[model samples]
Target: MPSVVKWSHYALLAGFSAVLPVAAYAQTEVEAEAEPEAATTVTDERVVLEADIVYENSADNTIIAEGNVEALHQGRVLRADRLIYDRTTERARASGNVIITEADGSQQFAEEVDVGPDLTDGYAIGYSARLPGDATVAAKSAIRRSDGINALEHVVYTACPLCEEDTTPTWSIRARRAVLDEESQMISYRDAVIEIGGVPVFYLPYLSHPDPNSERRSGLLMPNAGLSSTLGAFYKQPYYWAVSDHSDITISPMVMQNVNPLLGVDFRKRFYSGAVKFETSFTHEADFDSDGETFGEETFRGHLYGNGLFAISPEWKWGFGVETQTDDLYDRRYDISGQGDKRGLYSNQPRRLLSQVFVTGQGDSYYTDAALLNFQGLRGEDDAARLPLVSPLAYADKYWDLGAYGFASVTASTAILTREVGADSHRASLGGDWNTMKILPGGFTFEPFAELRGDYYMLDEDVSGKDSVARAVGNTGAKLAYPMVRPGTNVDLMLEPAVMAAWGFSNVNDPAIPVEDSLLYEFDESSLFEANGFGNFDLYEGDGKVSAGLTARALWKNGTEVSTTVGRRWRSRADPAFDVASNLDGKSSDWLASASLKMGKKLELSSRVRLDEKDLSLSRFDMRAATSFDWFRAVGQYYKIDERISPAGTSDEGIFLRGEIQFTDRYSVVFGQLRDISRNVNTRQEIGIAYTDDCSRFELLYNRSELRDRTLGPTESFQVRFSLLSLGNFGSDSFE
Candidate 1:
C-alpha cells in the first residue's frame, strides 16, 4: 500500500547520496583527505510521509503508519512495514523490512530502524548496504549520525559478488568494528582481517581509508613492488594531494635495495579554457649499465616534462611543451618511457625528443601554423651543440574556388634555424597555384595546373652555399585520365589510365644553398606525377617531365575490395638535387607499384615496392598484413631499403609481429616481436597472459630487449598487475 507525493528522485537524494563514493571504495581514502570541519549546514527542505493504514493520537501528539509505510526527505527515502512518529519528541521508529535508499542511488536494508531528534540520527539492526559499483557492506548493526559519521559492529566489506552455489565472495574484509570519521572523512577498522576465497589470510589491529565528498580527496595511491637485477628489490609508493578543486599533485618515492631512492612529482591543473600537466623526477647515483655495474662519479640525474595550451580567441590558440633530460641513458635505465606531449608540435623521431612553443590559426579556406622548437637527442653519440634550435618555422595557406575558371591557392612560409656548432640559416618564401579539371563526353578527364614560387635566404658564412641567395621557379602541366568500368551482378571492376606532362623554368636548386629540410625523400605511386617530388621548399624540379600510371579497383558483393597502382616518371633533364640513392636522380625513375586488399573487416594486406629500371629487381619494399578471427588475431610488418637510399644512408631491413589469442571467455594471451633482419638481432619480444571479468583483472607479462646503447645491455623483465573494479589498481615489475 504505497502512495507517495510528487517528487524528483535526484533532487530528493542530492544531500546524502552525494557521499556514495565515500562508502563504495571507502577503504582507500583515509590518508588522503583532511578532517572535515565541525561546522554544520542547514537546507530548507521538509520530509513527506505516507502509508496505507494511518492512525493518530492527537492528545499524545503522535502518528502511527502500518503496512507499506514510507518517509522521504531530500531524496533519501525510508520504507518500512510499520512506522511510528512522535511529534512532541520529533523522533521516529520503523520495523519490518526496512529499506533506506540514499540520494546517490545506494541502498541499505535492515529489520529495524530508529530515528532521533529532527530525524537526523538514524540507526538500524541487521544492517546491510549495497553501494555503487556493486560493492557491499554488511554488519550486525549500524548507526548513521547526522554529523556525517557512520559506525558499525561486526562488519564485512567486498566488491566481488558471491557465486550462486558458493556463498563466499572471492575477496572481503572482515572487522570487529568500523567507524567512518565525520571530520577526516575516513573509515577506521578495529581488528580487521583480509580474506580471500573465504579464507582469512592477513590481519591488522587497525586500518583506515579516506572518503571525501564532491572532491577528490588526498590519499595513498596504488604502489609498485618488484625484484630486479639492476635495481634489486624495489618498492615505489605515491601520495596524492588534492590542492584544490581544479588542481592536484602527486609525489612518489621509489626505494630499492641496490640503488638510491628516487623522488618524482606530478602536477596537473585546469582553467576556464585549457589545462596543463607536468611531471619530474630526480635521483643521485653513478652511471650504471644493464648488468647493474656502476661507473663514473655520482651526481644528480633527473628529467622533466610539461605541456600546456590556451585559447587566445575562437580562431587562435597558443601552447608550449617541455621535454628535457639531464642524461641520455636515465630513461632507459630507470624505465621512464614516455617523454611528454605537446599539442601542435611534431616529434623528430624515437631517437630524439622535440619540444616547442607554437601559435596556430584557422578559418574557412585558410590555415596557419608557427612553432619554435628545440631538439634533445637521446643517443650516446648525439652532441647537444650539433642539435638545431628552430625559431619561428611558419606556414600559411589560403585557397579560392573560381567557378569554371579553376581553383587557385596562395601560400607563404618562413623559417629560421640556428645550431650551436653548425651553420645558421633563415628563409622566406611565397608561392601560388591554379588548377581546373574537365570531364569530356567519353568519360575522359583532363586537368591543367600552374604553379610559381620565389624564395629569399640568409645563411651563415661557414656554410658552403652562400651568405645570401634568391631564386624563382615555376611549372605548368596538364593531366589526362580515362576510366573503363565493368559492372556485374556480383562484382564491380574499374580501370583508370592516366598521364601527366609538365615543364619547369628557373631552376633554384643550388648546391651552395645547403639542403635544410629535404634530406629525406621517397617516391611512390601517389607522387609519381608530381612536377616536384621533393616534400619541402628547399628543392625543386625545373625541367620537362612526363608520368604515366594505371589504377585498378575491384569490389565484390561479399564486401571484399582490392586496389592497385603502377606508375613511373621520365624526366627530360634529371634533377641534380637528387642523390644516386634517391632513385629519382636518373632521367627514368624506378617503377613504383602499390596494392591493397581489405576482406570484410577480417583480413587486410598492403604492399608498396620500387623496382630497378635496369632489371626490374626490387629496390625497396614495404608490406603489411593483418587478420582477425574468433579465437586469434595477428599483424605483421616488413620493410627493406638499400643502405644508400635510407635516410641514414645505410641499408636496413626489419620485421615486426604481434598477436593475441583468446582461449576462453576470461583468459587471453598476447605475444609480440620486433627483429632487425639485416643485423640478425632481436630488438624486443613480449609475452603475456591475462584474466578478466566484469569486476576484476589480472595479468602477468614477460618482456625482453636486446638493444645495447652506451652501457645498457640486453635484459629480461617480468611484470604483474591486478585491479578490482571501482577500487584501484596495483602492480609490480622486475628485471633480471
Candidate 2:
C-alpha cells in the first residue's frame, strides 16, 4: 500500500502516478537556463519524482523512494536506485548507482550523494565527472560548496583516450588534492605526479592551469633545454602575460653555461581592422673572430623583426617588413633564424637581410606601390659601404581594353639610388605595349605586338656619356602558332609549334648606368617566347631575334599526364657585351628542353636541360623525382652546371635526397642528405625517429651541418621533443 503525505510549506514531489493521489503536490515547472556556477533559480519550479515504490512518513516529515528512483528539478536530472527526501530540511540523499546530468550535458556519477534543495551544492563518494574538452576527473570523494568551488581528494585527471581492453591511459595526472574554481575557470592541484604508461615520470608540489574551456590566460609556458657547441648547455623559460582581450606578450629568458644569457620577447595585438606582431632578442657576449677565437670585451648582439598590415579600404592596403641583425655570425652561432629545413637556409645561407617600408593600392584596372628599401650584407667578402640605399621608389601600371580584338597596358616607374663607391642616380621610365590576336584559316593563330619606352636619367658622375641622358626605344613583334590534336581511346595527344620574331631599337648599353638589377641570367623553356629575356630593365636584349619552340602534351583517362618542350633562339649577330655563359653571345643559342611526367598521385618526375648545339653536350641539367607508397616516400634532386654555362665561372653540382618510412601505426623514421658534388662534401644531413598516438607524440632528431662561414664552423646536434595533449611540449637539444 502507498500513502501520500504533503507538508504544509513545501511540495517535495510532483507528477507521481503510482497508486496514490497525483495532483496534491503539483506546481508550475521552472523555465530557466543553466549556468556555469549553478542552475537558475525559479520560484515556481517543482521537484518531480518518480519511482517504483514511495512511502511518506508523516511524523518524520520524510519521503523514501526505491527501485529506479528519478528526480527532475530546474532542468537538471538525477537518477539512483534509492532516494530519500527530507521535507523539513529541504534536502535529498541518493544511494546506489547515483548519476546527475546538468543541462549543459555535463555528467557526474557516484555511489552515494547528499545535496541541498537546489542540487547545486552537493557531496559525493566514489565520484567521477566528464566535462568538455574530453576531460575526465575521478576522485575518492568530492565536495561542492555554495560558492561554486569543487574540492576533491585523491584525484586523477586525464584527457587521454581509454580502451576497455587496456585501461591504462597514455598520460595522466595524479594529485592528492585538487580544487576547481568555476568563477575563475581554473584548476589547482597539490602534490601532483605525472605518469606515462602507468610509470611516474615527474612530480610537482603545486601546480595550476587554466581550465580546458579557457582561451587565454597569464601563466608559465613549457620550458626548453638544449646544448650547443658554441653556447654549451642552454635552457629557456617563458612566461606569457595576457594584458587584455586584444593583446598579449611572451618573455623568454635563456641561460647558457659558456656564454652570456639572452632575453627574448614577443608582442602581439589585434585591431578592429588588422593585427600586428613583433619579436626581438638581445644578448651581451664576447664576439668571436674569424679564427673561432673570442674577444676580450663583451658586446651587445640582437635582432629585431616585425611586420604589420592594415586596410584603408577593400582595394587599398599598406604594409612594412623589418629584418635586421647585429652581425653576420649571430644568427648562425645562436641558431636564431632558419631553425627548420627550408630551401633558403641550405641553398642561400644567411648572407643578406632586408628591411623595407611600403604602401600599395589596387583597383580594377590599375596597381601602384611606393617603397623605401635597405639591405644588410652578412658575408665576409661583401663591402657594406658600397651597398646601395634605394629611397622613394614608385611604380604604377594600368591596363585598357583596345576594342574587342586587343588590349594595351602602360607602366611607369621611378627610383633614386645612392651608393658609396658607385655613381648615384635618379631615373624614371614609362612604357606602353599593345597586342592583338587573330585566328586565320587552317586553324592557325597569329598575334602581333608593339611596345615603346622612354627613359630620363640624372647622374652625379658619368663614365661613358654626359651627366644627364634621355633615350627612347621600341620593339615590334609577331607570333604564329599551329595546334594539332589527336583523340584516342585511352589517351589524348596535342602538339603545338610556335615561332616569334621581334625587331628592337634601343640606345646602346651605357657603362655609366650601373647594373643594379639583372646581374644573374638563365635561359629556360619558359622564357623562350618572352619579348625580353632579361629579368629587369637594366639590360635589354637589343636588335632583331627569332625564337621557335614546339610543345607536346599527352593526357590519359587514368589521370596520367606528360608534357615536353624544346626551343632555341637565333640572333642577328653575336654581341661582344654578352657573357659566354649567357648563351646569347652566339649566332644560334643553346637548345633548351624540358619534360615532366605525372602518374596520378603516386609518382612525379621533371627534368630541364640546356645542351650545346655544336657538340650536343649537356651544358646545364636539373632533375627532380618523387614517389610515394602506402608505407614509404622518397624524393631526389640533382643539378649540374658546366663551367662555361655557369654565371660564377665555375662548375656547380649538387644532389639532395629525402625519404620517410612508417614501420607501424605509431612509429616512423625520416632521413635526408644534401651533398655538394663539385666540392665533394656533404653540406647537411639529418635523421629522426618519431612516435605518435591520439594523446601524445615524441621525436628524436640528429642533424649535422658542414657549413664553413668565418667564425661559424661545422656543427652536429641531437634533439628530443615530447608533446602531450593540452599540456604543451617539452624539448631539449645537444650540439657539438
* Per-model tally of clashing residue pairs: 16, 0
The positional error of residue 467 in candidate 2, measured at the CA in angstroms, is 2.5
Q: Residues 1-736, candidate 1: write the lDDT tens digits.
A: 0000001111112322322221211211221245332111111332455678776667886666789877676677878898766666766667898777877787777777676654345677887766665667778877767886677789887776655686677667788988765566556679988676689966879765554342376767756788776787889988888899999999999998877889999999999988898889999999988877778899999998888999989998888888888888888878885764433456656768788899989988899999999999998788999888999899999999899999999999999998989888799999999999999898999999999999888988676557988899888999999999999899999999999999988456877776778776676787877877765888787788899999999999998999999999888877778886656787988889999999955999999998888888777899999989877888999999876467777779999998878899978897889999888878999899977666667778888888788788888889777665554665742111
Residue 151 C-alpha lDDT in model 1: 75
Candidate 1 runs further than 4 Å off: 1-82, 97-107, 117-119, 131-133, 173-196, 199-213, 340-343, 483-494, 554-561, 598-601, 625-630, 633-636, 648-650, 732-736
Give the range of the ten consecutive residues with the poorest summed lDDT in model 1: 1-10
Candidate 1 CA-lDDT value: 0.76
Q: What tens-digit string does per-residue lDDT give for candidate 2 at 631-687? A: 778899999999987887899999999887889998888778899999887789889
- What is the Cα-based lDDT of residue 231 in candidate 1? 81
**RMSD (CA, angstroms), candidate 1:** 8.5
